[model samples]
Target chain A: EPEVTQTPSHQVTQMGQEVILRCVPISNHLYFYWYRQILGQKVEFLVSFYNNEISEKSEIFDDQFSVERPDGSNFTLKIRSTKLEDSAMYFCASSGQGVTYEQYFGPGTRLTVT
Target chain B: AQRVTQPEKLLSVFKGAPVELKCNYSYSGSPELFWYVQYSRQRLQLLLRHISRESIKGFTADLNKGETSFHLKKPFAQEEDSAMYYCALSGRGSARQLTFGSGTQLTVLP
Candidate 1:
């Protein structure tokens, strides 16, 4: 079974610094999403990307956050200026074109903004 | 707005014991429900979806539309069932992004 893959399993950065999390979704998948879970909190949806544009985003996805599918296989999330509250486990997920509801998740990247 | 609530923060049961994790949602329109499980150091994996109505790894969940609840149940939970379970909901049509609950940490003791 093909699985979503993320790079830099753990990231530590100073407050106000920029950070970018990278993911490579499963081949042939079209719908991509970004979610985050603060320690001991529920997983919160950030944004969803499809056809090279943002399909939907939650209120939590503010101007500081941006997502890009720079290449055919690579999807990335960039935080312009990190805050301490931004520290969380960031997960990348994807689903096939037909079955967009069934998402496959990557082993999240743990971001720590100190 | 959409919201998912998993009432139990933690639950434990001995091996082979029946287990249930409660979930409720607040959505105006028709919604799709799903249960995702995450084991130690593993990525979140889909356990079951309300639309499918199929059992996976001895677990089943029935969506009660009237009550706006979709609770996960297992007749006999094994030790390997210990994991964090999240109940998620998504609205139909274009807005399909998931809204997840706080998640329940289930420990199946041996």
Candidate 2:
């Protein structure tokens, strides 16, 4: 079965540096989402992207966070300035349409902001 | 606030044993519930949804709106069923955004 794929399975960065997590959603899927889980915490939603725009966002996704669909296949989450608390497992997911609620998630990228 | 809660952090059972993973949710209006599973070294994937009303891989979950619970159950636990199980909930007539539980780690010892 086709699945969402993410690059850089793990990322390490300085506290003040920027990091971009990349994801390639399944072809033919429309809705894309970003979620994260801090170690030992529940997975939290970050943002949802559709039609090249954001549909929803959580408080954790502040100004430092931005998502872009630079290409037909790539969806990226960019953090302008990382904080220690930013370390977490970032997951990318996609669904076929808005009517359907099922989402397929990628393996996730472990981000560590030291 | 929307929330999903899985009370058990870990559950261990022997092969052929019955297993139940409990999930509870707090949502005001109509709710949609789902169970997702993640095997070791595998991506999280949808196991089953309450709306489907169908069983998958011998696992089934029934949504109890009266009790705000959706518990996953399987009559016989197989080693392959050992994985991290997460319960999720979404509200009706709104965004499909999901609120997930902390998750339950199911281990079926051979």
Candidate 3:
């Protein structure tokens, strides 16, 4: 079965630095999303991207966060300035164009900001 | 606002015993509910969806709109059933975005 793939399974960055977490969603999927989970916390939605634009975003996805589909398969989330609280497991998910289609999740990238 | 609640942080059951993972949601509009499981070292994957109304790997979940719950259940649990299960919800307006619960870690002891 085809699955979503993410790069840099784990990353360590300094505070105030920028980091990009990349994901290659299933080839045929049309909608992409980004979610994060702080250690011991529930998964939180960050943003959703479709048609090269952001569909919705949460308060956590503030000015420092941005998502881009620079290529057909690549969906990238960039944090302009990383903070200690920004450390978490970031997951990328994608789904087909139907309302009932379940979103497939990637292995997730663990971001650690010191 | 849409929210998912999985009250149990951990549940342990012996093999061959029945297992039930509770999930409740709060959403004004109709919402889509799903159960995702993640085994150790594996990525989170969809286990079942309420709309399908089908069983997967001997597990089934019924969407109780009156109770606003979609609890997952299996009649007989196996050792392989040990994993972290999350209850998620997607509202009509934000179908692509999912709000997940804190998750329940089920351990099926042999």
Candidate 4:
């Protein structure tokens, strides 16, 4: 079975620096999403992408956050000027066009902004 | 606006015993509920959804609109059932982004 894959399972970066987390969603899926889980907190949705544009986003997705499908297979979440509160485990997920609600998640990338 | 609540932060059950993970939601409109499970060091996977009304891996959940609950139940718990379970809700229309509850970590002892 195909699975969503993410790069740099663990990322440690200095505060105020820009970081881009990468994900390769399962091929043929149409919808892609980014969610984050802070320590001991529930997973929160950040943004959703479809048709090469953002379909929806949460309040947590502020001006500092941006998502792009730079290529056919890669979905990237870039955080400009990271803050300490931004430290969390970021997960990438995708679902096929047929079942938009059934999302398959990638092993999360743990980001620590020092 | 939309929120999911899993009251119990942690639960424990012996192998062969029954287990229940409680979940409640607050939504004005008809809600779409789902249960996602994360095994140790693994990604979150869909266990089941209320719309499907199907049982997966010996687990089942029924959505009760009156009570606004979608509690996950298992008749016989196995040791492998130990994992973190999250209850999520999706709103109507195209976005369908999930709003998850604080997960319940279940430990099934052998």
Candidate 5:
């Protein structure tokens, strides 16, 4: 089965530095999403992207966050200035055009901020 | 506001025992409920959806709109059933993002 793939399974970055978490969603999916889980916490939605624009975003997705589908396969979540609170495991997900609600998640990327 | 609540943080049962993982939700309109699971070191994946009314891995969940609950149940628990379970809810409107419960850790001892 095709699965969503995320790069840099683990990353450590300094506070205030810019970081980008990349994801390659399922090839045929039309909707992409980003979610984060602070250690021991429930996964929280960050944003969803479709049609080269953000379809929805949570309050946690503030000015520091931006998402882009730089190419056909790459969906990225960039944080302009990382904060300590930003340290968490980020998951990428995708689903077919009509059934986007049923998302398939990737093996999250663990981001640690120092 | 919409929310999902899984009261129990952890549950442990012996093999061959029946298991129940509770889940409750708060939503006004018709809600779509799902139970997702994550095995150790693995990605979160869908275990079953209330809409399908199907069982997966001996697990089943029934959506009770009146009580606003979708509790997962398994007739005979197996050791391999140990994992993290999350209950999620989606509203009827557009762009209905899922709201998940805190999750329950189920451990089926051998």
Candidate 6:
């Protein structure tokens, strides 16, 4: 089965540096999303992207966070000035059209800011 | 606001025993519910959705709107069923962003 794929399974960055997490969602899917999970915490939604624009975002997805579909296959999330609290497992998901379709998740990228 | 609650942090059952994982949601509008499972060293994957109303791998879940719950159940559990299960909900829209619960780790002991 085709699955969502993410790059840089694990990343370590300085507190003030910028980090970009990349994901390649299923080719035919139209909707994409980004979620994060702090260690020992529930998964939290960050943002959703469709048609090269953001559909919705949470409070956690502030000005420091940005998402881009620079190409047809690549979706990337960039965090400027990463904070210690920003360390978490970031997951990317995609789903086909329909209200009942299930979203498929990627393996996730573990971001560690020190 | 939409929220999902999975009260049990951990649950264990012996092989061949029945299993149930509880989930509850709070949403003003009609919401979509789903169960996602992640095995050790594997990525999170969809197990079942309320809309399908079908069983997968001998497991089934009923969406109880009256109780505001969607509990996953299996009559006879197997060792392979051990994994982390999450209850999630999405509001009625195109965003399709999910709000997930803390999750329940189920261990099926042999």
TM-score of chain B of each: 0.97, 0.97, 0.97, 0.98, 0.97, 0.98
- For all predicted structures, in order, the TM-scores are 0.98, 0.97, 0.98, 0.98, 0.97, 0.98
TM-score, candidate 3, first chain: 0.98
* DockQ-best of 1 and 3: 1
In terms of TM-score, how similar is model 4 to the real structure? 0.98
Summarize candidate 5's per-residue lDDT along A88-111 as a digit string, tens digits.
999998877555568899999999
lDDT of 1 by residue, A20-93 (tens): 99999998888999999999899999999999999999999999999999979999999999999999999999
Interface RMSD of each: 0.9, 1.3, 1.2, 0.5, 1.1, 0.6
Off by over 4 Å in 1: none
Query: Which runs in model 6 stand beyond 4 Å of their true positions?
Result: none
Model 3 has an lDDT value of 0.94
Candidate 4: docking tier: high
Each prediction's Cα lDDT score? 0.94, 0.92, 0.94, 0.95, 0.91, 0.95
lDDT of 2 by residue, A8-93 (tens): 99999999999999999999988889999999999888999888899888899999999999979999999999999999999999
lDDT of 2 by residue, B35-85 (tens): 999999998889999989999999999999899999999999999999999
The window of 10 residues in a row where model 4 chain A has the poorest summed lDDT is A94-103
Worst lDDT run of 10 residues, candidate 4 chain B, spans B89-98
TM accuracy, model 5:
0.97
Clashes of each: 0, 0, 0, 0, 0, 0
**lDDT tens digits, residues B1-110, model 5?**
88899999999999999999999999877899999999999999999998899999999999988898999999999999999999998677455567889999999999
Write one digit per residue (lDDT tens) for candidate 4, span B1-110: 99899999999999999999999999989989999999999999999999999999999999999899999999999999999999999988687889999999999999
* RMSD, every candidate, angstroms: 1.0, 1.1, 1.0, 0.8, 1.1, 0.8
True contacts kept of each: 0.84, 0.68, 0.78, 0.92, 0.54, 0.89
Tell me chain A's TM-score in each of the predictions. 0.97, 0.97, 0.98, 0.97, 0.96, 0.97
